[model samples]
Target chain A: MEEQLIECDVLCVGGGIAGLMAAIRASELGANVVVAEKGNPHYSGCGRRGNDHFETWIPEVHGADKEKFIDELLKTAKGEILIGRDILRAQFGKAHEIVELWDEWGIPMRQKGKWEFAGHAFPGRMMTHIKYEGRFQKTVLVQQARKRGARIMDRIMVDELLRDGDRVIGAVGVHTREDTVFVFQAKAVILGTGKCSRLYQGLTPGMMFNDGHGGVQTGDGRAMAYRAGAELMNVEMPQRHIGPKYFAKFGQATWVGVLRDAEGKPVGPFVSEPDRRYGDIVMEVNKLAPEQYGERGRGPVYMDCTGISDKDAAYMRHWHIHEGNVSLVDHMDAEGIDPRKHPIEFSTYPLRGGGLIVANEKAETSLPGLYAAGDEAMGDISAAATFGWISGDTAVAYARTVEHGDVEVTRPIIAALESRIDELRGRGNGPDWEEANIALQQVMTDYAGKVRNEARLLQGLAHLRRLRQKVDTELMARNQHELGRCLEVHNLFDVGELTFHAALDRRESRGLHNRPDYPFKNPLLSQAHIVRMEGDRPVTDWRSY
Target chain B: MPPIINPDLCIKCDRCVNICTEDVFFGSKKHETPVITYPRECVHFNGCVDVCPVPGAIWLRYPMPSMIVYRTSSDYRAPPG
Candidate 1:
């Protein structure tokens, strides 16, 4: 029953790429920042492992004009970006400075005195990506934050936000390993807990919860924001991703270069094939994979690297050292699966969808004193960095204006959170976190998957409601780690239900949500469905950019 | 499948135990190698391998699913290595 109280000006939760960047920025701006992460900050969250490509604006390399970039984005970027223009503009303006700061921090993405860009130059670069060895990006960012005097409290998972009236003041969490409770009272809170977990068991008749994206990203931030009455955007867009079937970790950009079918036949005319957007391997694979790829009857797919010259192979190998999941190379080597000698196998993994917090250019959620970053802000890495930076600036400024004490607001919230933990610890036998997690994933994939219908969505919605009951009353955790997972599963279920409701609300098929029931886009429902909590239930408000 | 620790080379430094964010291995004892209790829980990020000071002290064994390049025998267009 150890209780710990941390007071800071800015509290950055999640500690992934965006959270770390936010911490560094906030701390640099003279805020006493504290980062509360569920896992080790260096190797946690979606961006923990590493990334090889950073999507940015390298104008010199790929003629950068704001209008043309936004125009091309509507043309090529993934999914329907109805309200992401301002976010894109924010990222575009800050790309050069962010890269420069990153370079100064040691991982010089740009080559000396030049912007060496790679990937996606069709029509003109869509400000999509540039190849870099950013394996140590998270670690370096963590170091920078510490150097600027930000205290990183790893292994604490923030479960709920502390609010006063409509504004969020702080958060409450528990230790993932020990019996410790953390009460973080901050002037401004940055909910950079990344996006939802890789929850949807992709294209399978049964549930396969193997597709986890880095350290458990189960939409804790978005869920917390929702419960706190913060408006959430894009809750229904099921974030589909095609990845290596078995080794299903998240960021595998540029890893699988050229994919060939099971018959040694190349999946030609790939968008990557023409543009060399090596990062689009997944999208290309998805476009080319046979109709029923992951099903038992379907043929296997492979990444064929046999045609690559010896010189290029060595060069590729060298580049991987700087990227995250460098461990994959070790895994491949240990398995004796050579990309050159043996065609590397791959398949798909799917998350139910992104339930992103509705954030402005400054990363402010609808709720005051609360901000969202990372994919929770729903932009690429450059946007993540940019949003993280700007949110820090805005949050620190907001924090400076607030009074120091909020004990009256935090006291009752802390008592409730403690009792909740005690209840979980006291429980003996009930469904474990895995059972509940798998059940929710099944529900999501079965009803609210890629293709959906009104009847199916309603059925899924009812099942989710029942499942939420089970998760609330019966879900038990043995120790701190299990408790952490239980908290994550709870958040995932909440986010899943939000997505289901959003799916049910949106009658027509648009973007990632496909409703064969209503074949075409409904002009009436063209705007983004912004979901917010109204007196305990989520209500959707249609908002146009 | 799971990481096989070479006891001979393992000085029991506890780097793997401390670094694994997944909680894959049980917490370590002083001078005792950590137990890989939750082997099935290994998501296979290989933070342990990356942080291991001793070379080849820890290595991963990918499960059979990764090796299954061909889902069925009839589809023999590209055979497994």
Candidate 2:
């Protein structure tokens, strides 16, 4: 056995698109950087299976005017999360700069005039490379970081940050395969570990098995940041999108493009019509075609691509050939029809996008030298591609500002981390991280889901509230690997409170934060509901975008 | 064109919705399954089948010789005369 000592100026915790961008930015600024990803950099993270298309808040993509996009986002924000006009506008304006950053890293963006794509009202302003595998984007970004002298440590489960006083100086993580623990020292520590969508019960069916299995997200950044006295935001309200209703169905990505009427019938001109927000039509579809929709059998309309051309089948075949997403392909085969020759059926289920975490423009936390990125960082950019890029860029910029100055780190903080690590190691070697993690998912799924009322939300909040406390006191990890999972669940318990609280504060329905009790979008609640753990009691405030 | 499908290999994940530069596929509604509405928009790039987590779920049939000849640009150009 050999000990490897690696040092850097900036340490990135996750290697998704956001982490990669941050690493690139820091490296360019002449900083020695190290990125530790919990999973394989190539096969894991949202960047692995998603389109390379970038969604910008620019008017070219939204419409001839920028106000509509801003308004649409404010509408989506729906009273929770920060919607500051300047902040939102600034995030949008940086889209090109972020794209240029990607371009500098050798990830070529397709430049097509009058571009047309799926899932947008206007032509795509996104620079997309369509003819290649989705992972190609990640592969290229990782390669760029490697070229820039950024060290990448893959499959290392980061358990906690190594703190000195209130400042985050480094991280302590373990290699999952070899079970080797390493303390990574740096001038700045950035949290880019995506989100915990998998923790929200049955909503994450296919995603339940991947390493953290939706368990890793639970706001690891948020929990750690809060413990360090950083301000958290919108902890009460988590966002859910329309998802698949079947067992472990993972193909919700393709169906997001389908548009239909209340009767589950094809809308307008089928293939040629421009894409628009069909969410409003969900209620109508439920009314007209309940039998076809799902268990509730509301307006279960789907896309009718029975007239697919041969060329189109070849295009879709590439995904099945490469990624092996057989849900659609197998259904087509069973029906004895081809997607190129016949239309495939489509529908929606409820999918939570995880709540947003708040941070300043520099990706700085209330606690200094601690930064947040990816799904855990907030402002108006949690789930979108543009926001992820911006977060990464912002975090890297702040990391550059960090200097190993004459300022001394307090001894108390270092002692605290060491004591906590020792205490965690001393606990009973019994709790299965996977089982507890799955239990957390079931709890969130059953109670705090798409149709949240006071009863279910309260019940979920109460149980998760208590569950978090018990896990902290009773649960113990036998090794560093299990400890990583334990920390993830603990973070989930903290962030889950944010989701529940936000849902309770805003007594109205808007965008993804839908409420069956308060079914209509309430204009009175249009003001953003800002919640932060101000001195124990979850304090709530209001602001406008 | 022959149809293609491979089922035992399908997990039905939604990577296709996240990709598809052309917005060719739409997600399913509550009761019904998802559908691919715009086959014409497909550029035959193979991103969908290639990105599927399961290998054999997507089936591919070759373009027939006659059908290929009919849709070719050369065949359409001469007919304008």
Candidate 3:
């Protein structure tokens, strides 16, 4: 396959919300921009399925001081992680801008009054969320970007970053179906690939193993950045959300209802606070379910939406469909399960990559010319939108200062990557990439999952190292799809290794990094665990929060 | 659970082939009709159907109760179980 060279003033990788926003912003800023997406931008990343609401801080809606909103945002970190204050402030400060942009793009945000908003998350009474039909979020974004003269290239799976000295110059990716390598040379590149959600066993079984976000989010952005010597923050702290045990295929069903026992009684006190962490909520349910409903029925816990009004139920159903899980309505109908009647069984699943790609207030990574946004930059949709906006302006400014310098794609780098792909294609017999991936997930889930200790993490790390060896030597891919899978597994291995090592290093129990041995959050360990490539190996260092 | 492509409706544009991140539609050669080679890999995000220029060319059947039951049973073991 011949290497195709493409050049742009700003190259936005992974055309999810962040990438799309960046491309739109950059192109609007008068920079030649190209967005290389693994899938169609209209239905890529978590936003492929629309979200229930956009969490924003409109002063009229929030009614809180900017400092209070920032405090609430930092509270979500649970004192376990050090979130960048500047980044948080920027995201909060720019929330109204994002909402305004979405409004202009014809995204239907449900506003109650001149200042009143609908669907705020928790704790705060100020309605921060403007309920929107987000099913066409990606499509709207693509349209907006295209209207502003941004080039959107789909089916380009970027696997490696091309760097000149310490600065990232471009990226190399395979055109999945065409079997062509795309070498995108750019003055600036923004990565918006979503989190690594498939490292553990997901709600689904078989080939589509991880179903929380989408099968496509394999932590490609984080892996590429890590390999390119960019620092990743909080890699050990995995975020999990509670959802229906059997309905993982239905996408995220907001935990709007109460947790009830088999006796049709509320299992726990319903805390409607905005600052309530989903993890804590899950923990509460886990503890209460087995105790109250263990002997009463077969199913342990259920999210009782029975108390919700018919109008609310209808709204929930509409939100579910709008979120791209159209089949969910059919599934619910066929099961004869009405939210107004029976409760739905609940379970927890991992959300995104544990740590995020470390970036400054401008969403620029430590490596020059490379920026991150969205889940890759470690925030919710509002944060991602804010960072995406900032990164675009930042990249455009950076591009103005620098020329499209000659990016020498060294023979050694090309040969090494090609050899790995060839080896997978050529192998006749070995462990199937899917089976290896399953094994990897099993190891991670068993030892390094939600419940963890130092010993188990060490064991998981050792097991992961062995699995990495198998993936490196015996992995096989007969076609382009399998080749993509092989690459995903390779990225997954890097993520797993980094996560395990980071977990091992963080002895105290903090936010999502639950440790049985260290049952309490250590004040000393409040710093961020920064992971970077030291030569061929990864090293972890702690920075003060 | 692969998507059921209506042969009668499909224009064979291979839009489904290009759009699927799961690569459920296996058609390597140009103009080759996309086949559901890896049925179980389909997560049913409906990207194929969404991208299909022909309306109703690709559709998905709701997964069977037994399949959902089995998956939930196997995948949802509580932590420390």
Candidate 4:
């Protein structure tokens, strides 16, 4: 048996957009960096999946209409779309800089007519080339990182962040294939681990290979920060989206056209139009009145593609070409009615968005020398794609501010990481990571999902509290791989509990933080709720957004 | 027609619910499988078939006339301005 250890100025966990972007920036700043990716870095996370719409085609087609298209985002986030406006503008302003970086690294982005070739609007299609896809983009970035003298380890899972006193030094993770645990020492650690969707039940579109597809973001990075004593914000404001469930299997269909409710009733503009935004086509069914849909009570709204113009229908068929344009035909066959003739049945449910982490515009977590990026850290930045890129840039800039050469700040942290690795090795079979992981996922999906009440939140919080106690005691992992899973479960518990506590404390609904018991948005509670680990207990505070 | 469903083998992603044009299928955001609504409206585009990641969750059946009927703009239109 051999023990493996590595050293770098900065160690980034996860290889999604944030991690790759961070690695590149760190290398440019002249630091030894390493990235450990649990899966192939090139693939898209929840971000890149489905049509590549928002940041892609919409911008090209609309141009100044960008404001109008982005209006959907603002509306989705309940009119606070500009919450991360500063961060988004910064990210978009540097779009060309990022593209240049990608170009210099040999990654091909469509500059000419790739989007037109794909039948999308022309203006919105800049940087629209379908190179090896988002995952391949990660692959290319990782390769570029290697060229710049950064080391990369695949299939390595970071189980826990190594801490010394109040500051985080590094992390201890397990290398699956080798079945051995290793420690990495660093002056700074960047967590870009992405979202935790598998925490919920329904299938999310991207990265089934990773833990949370789109349901419950595992909240691994947040947990690590909390355990090491860092502040967290808005963990309870889960971004629940109502997506076309059938899109995953049947290729995408034109949903906006054939809107309907759960009982197969038509609740069109023929009913309530003023109260809802967009056409009745885009409004959620719950937003419509019962009389509008003719009775069985509205469960969800469906898009009736049958009523859309032929041109619109064709556009939809072309848009969903990835799944072979089977959706149009599926609509025809399943209902035995021509989509050219009838409206489709549809419903609305919940989808978890990139949960927000309460950091200032700079992507800095509450911890010193540690920054959170990507889905791992939640907040206003989570909603906007452009803002996500900006958060990455901000994190990189902040990381550069720290001079890694100053051992006075980083050396002890690295040493502490080594010690933590020894602690895991000593505590053999301490906890069952997989079961605990499932339990946490259930807690998030069942209680914290879509419709939430104080009772459910309290119940989930209590369960998380118990899980926290058991995580260090009853859970046991057979090997290093299992050990990482155990850590992920522990992390989810920590994150879920924080989210529940925040949800409970908020006492009112606003944006994604919906408490059914307090459905209406209370201006009194419009401020953001903040929490951080103070010793063994989590401390809470409030800040105006 | 019992209306098309292969319960044992549904990945339950609910792509069918999104694609259905006749208001025939629905599912919960949290549920694994979708519920068939207005089974009569299903036109059997067979789109749900290939789109389904799982092999055999949906069963295509004959369209029922009792369901609401719709016409595309290409077929129905105002005379002229």
lDDT of 3 by residue, A359-408 (tens): 88889898999999998885667777778888999999999999885667
Kindly provide the TM-score obtained by chain B of candidate 1 when compared with the true chain B: 0.77
Ranking by DockQ, best first? 1, 3, 4, 2
Over A1-545, each residue of candidate 2 has an lDDT whose tens digit, in order, gives 12244567888888776677678777866778898887656544555543434445434545665556666655543234444575556566665456555555554443342333333232333321122134366777778889889898876666566666567777666664353556677778777777665556542343343221223445666666665566666555554433322322222333223344344344433234213222122322232232334556454344433344445445455444333244334444544555333333333333444454565555666566777766666422223334545544555565666655222243444445445555666886645555666667777767766678888889988888677766766777665545555666667666667677778877877755668888888786666566666667666677553
DockQ of every candidate structure: 0.38, 0.03, 0.26, 0.06
Interface RMSD of candidate 4, in Å, is 13.6
The TM-scores of all predictions, comma-separated, are 0.91, 0.69, 0.89, 0.66
Assess each prediction's global lDDT (C-alpha) against the native: 0.74, 0.53, 0.74, 0.52
User: Clashes in model 3: which pairs?
Assistant: A122-A273, A122-A274, A123-A273, A123-A274, A196-A353, A234-A355
Under the 3 Å rule for N, CA and C atoms, how many clashes does model 4 have?
Answer: 75
For DockQ, the strongest prediction is: 1
Per-candidate clashes, comma-separated: 7, 93, 6, 75
Which stretches of model 1 miss by more than 4 angstroms?
A62-64, A120-128, A202-209, A255-257, A262-301, B68-81
CA displacement after TM-score superposition, residue B43 of candidate 2 (Å): 28
How do the residues A482-519 of candidate 4 rate in per-residue lDDT, one tens digit apiece?
44545566666666777777777877777656677988
Instruction: Write model 1 residue lDDT over A261-282, tens digit each, in one string.
Output: 6766655454433233343343
